[model samples]
Target: MRDLFMQAVAYTSMWLAQREVFAYRDEALQNWTLPGGVEEVQATVLAKLRVALDYARSSNAYYAGVFASVGFDPLTMRGLEEISVLPIMTKDDIRRHRSDFEACESMNSHRVEGKTGGSTGQPLKFSMSRDDYLRSVGIGLAGWHFCGYVLGDRVGVLGGASIAKQDAVPWHISRSDLALNRRQFSAAVMDDNRIAQYWDYIARWEPAYLRGYPFALAELCRHRPKGCAGHYRPRAVLTTSEMLTESDRHIIEKALGAPVFDGWGLNDGGASAYECREHIGMHVDTTRAYVETVDDAGRPVWDMPGRIVVTSLTNKAFPFVRYDTGDMGVLAWRGCKCGRSGLMLTQILGRCDERLNIGGVRTEACAGSWLTDIDRVRRWRIVQDGPLHITITLDVDAGFDKRASEEAVTLSFVSRCSTVSIAFVYAPLPLPTDGSKWRSVVVLDSARHQTRVVAEKHA
Candidate 1:
């Protein structure tokens, strides 16, 4: 009875809030529609950058002082090419001068305190203003156009993101999730019975669009308890937070009966990118931020995967100019066949912390294909605590073997690194109380190194 009452309250509130959600969809359409192709995109990018820079310099004391020191003027930038003249920054730089980063007057309109889980294991707190918050929603709504989704459409999110932590109501019945017409089920609580219950909920809900962490949703589809393949196929499936491999994409699309649209973004509000229907490459939100790749010498590169640098264009409350997000990827020069005329990032390499530095091995070689064995396990997380000490946690299924699993993990590492002591913890995997979880690999024994990367549109 209480559940029904909450559902009633949620439905009524969302009906009242549908107007705002519709407006957000309309605004996203207006913001995303670039009719002029490449030239138009370039013009819009230049104009927005110019305006954002001027506003930051004029209203932000920190930027004002920094610009004066370098004798830099935002007004002088005639083209996107001029962005190169600005200095690239990192999270530490933002923290050291955190107080100086805000443009208080303009930022106070919709300010809310924000913090990042820091995928690289370094968390940071910051502020999120009105436009800062809404513009992200706008981009996400816009991306759904590719999925044939509009505001007020049913959206079911399957994850234990902090958004699920709201006290107002159950995630599926919350007014907040109603924007995409979203109904959410917690990924944090998972086991045979709970998963079966989730399957029952989803079968009944029959959402139009599905969104969540890749592993969470994939496992649900993988282990739907034999006879629970409900006739509920969504129009699209959206994955985010961590990297999405081609193999993962194919498996998900095949199992869920929906095309997958992957996205990437930083928790610090630095960058955002999403995959379109084409599924070839992700289109970066050039309107919200600028993405650039640099070589070992810090010189910009167009094609190769190098250190990625992100500059946030919208967040005046916390401007991230050329901030290193500590994830690596290659940047492509040409336009996507989907006809979107903007720079795109491809081949996302996980964080610098996730990189195997000892064997001087590439990521694919070191991480191996353990994820390919998703059929045996429900989910997996690996944390490298020390130079040679590692912890492997798994939420395995009925047929899962402890001895075989240990052998697989140990072999994957021993073939790559020596003197590695492995600890296997087989228990139900817990979802983060915060947002999306990152940093599956941690090297606590060594000083932190930096790199760059992106987000899922829903991130």
Candidate 2:
């Protein structure tokens, strides 16, 4: 009876949030239901791509100018291979011409604002129309459905400030959480006391499944309370936002007694791929984005690993066409053995950088959220040389206010780790060497402290 009641509340909350989410989810499921072989599915996806391309060519200002300059017309294009004529878009391009990327027709639609530091730790603010935002959510819900997660099943989400802010509340549970039958745990603060509190909440809540960053889940496993796994066990664990290393996967599985399902996606609403029950590789979500592998020169590559490029299908508000994701992956031409078709990524080799941990707390990508809307800041980097000391280097524009930004940075870190020391360094931050993805947070000797945390868990 309680389960039925929670499910009812979940459906009600989802309806209140977005009236069309379920419809979008149904639309996304069409990919799975498409009749016939792989070629048929590919044809359907390319049809959508054709629509997206033509929309950007006619609607988006940036694409309009680029299309004119290159003399490439999606309307005149004969085949999918012709898409290669479009130039690959870099992060710098979007950073400079963000406004021009928006479709002129979507100006009147309500916009949902978001920001990401991306792989380079350079902040970029983006938005999508209300309909596009709901579509993205629907597509994500479809992915969760593939993982055997039903809406309204109790879920405990462990995430950063972006997902669940570190509020003043003791349990960090919010009203919206109750409405959806979800519990929120802070990934920003994982000290011993907080970890203990999290476990207590989990034991009582007995969530049907748990979802969080790989590092945060690994930390929970390392310091999990005695016999905590005995009292309750989740059906499955979902991990995302960071690379899920094999070591972390093993640790989490051993601690929780459930299979760890990992996925990869961009915050920009561009592309996403999730691991099905097959556990072989992530299935490219063709319903939301079109993904492919390409060489540095924008030519498609299939025999070897190459840069991952994406074109968003749902987000017409800010069309991302031929957008270079600054990540490396290999696309398998074959379909999954699990009988699912369309697109599948054999591997994703991106965001492979060390994490910053002060004591038991490990910080991920939430730093991007902290620095959002700051006008003076251009690009930023976080470096940890000592255990409790962090230095933030910022590349500022003219008329930068050091005092205000410094206070903001200090308060952000100190709120998560009260004992940590914060310092500021101003300069033009260095670039990644030889086309490598930039290491956002650099920890000089992270392994030493990481080992200590595990050792203390045993003690």
Candidate 3:
């Protein structure tokens, strides 16, 4: 009964905010459903751009200057395709113009301020309003509902964040205005024994949904306790934070005996895409934002893969217009059979900076197929000793031909990057940084002082 009342209150508050802040969205979606076709989705996005431009021109100084620099008259910019004319904003631009990003007048002095985890090895700080916070939470909960989860359903979060360690120091779980629906288990401690203990606790909780970083979840699956394997059957498992490879997804779903869904977004923005029952690809949130895939030159790419650029329609607090998220993915131009009218993202290829270098050449391609084909095993690194070398480090697993994996991975690296050297080493894999997420590919070959990926950490 209490849960129902809380849910009612939350929904009521969300509805009021949706009407107050996103009135245009309400009117637009009145006749439309959660997922719409391509044309409808594009039209809705244009409508959102119109609304966002009005708010941005009035309140956001950053965008005002951006508009002036780009010589874009937002009023005359007709549709989503016209967005291609605007220059793409990089993370460096945001860092340099941090003050300009904020909607200073709208900021409440008491709101919480937080920094991103730099999971892509580039950290960023962004602000969120109380209402914005609520909206984000609401969208996430709604996505889970699409996958058959309810308001009070037990959920487990396996991600990294600073939480109070319950050792001698007194701690308190503060009851705040924010709706804290799920129990969080920290993945900061990578020790196998401690992780096992936490997994045991998760089983005790018997969560309906398991959600977190793909790497952490993969690690848990690798060392899953015998008795706890099938006992804690979750309704679904959702992977976020890192790219969900086919192998990892299959492993997770098989281990948990539930369908796994991928929810994609950045901490700076609210929910961008969510998988529906159809499970084809993520359906873009056309009501709140516009997404475009652009080539390296910032030109729009249709019918092919490119870097994803997103422009937020509702975030007056921060203008994320034409922001390059540093990730690569293909957005499907065709409509989904699911009868949804939102944009679809077919594939999320790794990050732009996570490319492997061979000898002296730079390449963003990988040779090995998902899990089953283990032959392409090679020692690889974006090594910066003095000059960037595609350092191939090879140690093949048993039963698989190590020599073949080495040859394939090495040859692929050589083909992409001409400056390469083969170094055969039988050593343990490099450990990821403390509290830092690992990318399968690393770009900082610091030995030669080539800093391709540069985003300063906040501390």
Please, what are the lDDT tens digits per residue for candidate 2 over residues 1-459? 788898888888899878699998887777755676567777777788888888887777788888888888776666566788788887799867766765453563677777764445565677776777787788778888767887788988876644455442226667877887778776656677878888887888788989887767776776788866566778899988766656567678877888998888785746877788899888777877888788768988874677788887767667788887766777865677777776778776654234566756755433444653344444566778676788788776678777766777778888878998878787975333221223446776665475466659868
Provide the lDDT at 212 for model 2: 80
Model 1: per-residue lDDT, tens digit, 1-459?
A: 434454465546645744354355465454445677656766777887888788778877777887788787888888766666667676787767766765453457656677775556578777766566666666766766777765566667776543344222223364366533567667666566877877777777677778777766776777687667557788898887777755456567877788999888864655777787777777777767777887655667877867788766777776766677787888875567776756777767767556654333334322324544555565566665544556777776677667765787688877776655778887886545443553345555441221111112224
What are the clashing pairs of model 1?
162-434, 263-455, 263-456, 264-454, 264-455, 264-456, 265-454, 265-455, 326-451, 327-452
Candidate 1 residue-wise lDDT at 85: 60
Candidate ordering by TM-score (highest first): 3, 1, 2
lDDT of each: 0.66, 0.72, 0.61
Against the true structure, whose TM-score is highest? 3
Q: Which TM-score value belongs to model 1?
A: 0.77
Instruction: Report the alpha-carbon TM-score of model 3 versus the true structure.
Output: 0.79
Tens digits of per-residue lDDT for model 3 on 160-233?
65222222101122332224345665666656676677677776657677887776676677568677645778
Supply candidate 2's per-residue lDDT for 451: 44
lDDT at residue 371 of model 3 (Cα atoms): 25
Provide the global lDDT of candidate 1 against the true structure: 0.66
Pairs of residues at least 3 apart in sequence or in different chains that clash in candidate 2: none
lDDT of 2 at 395: 71
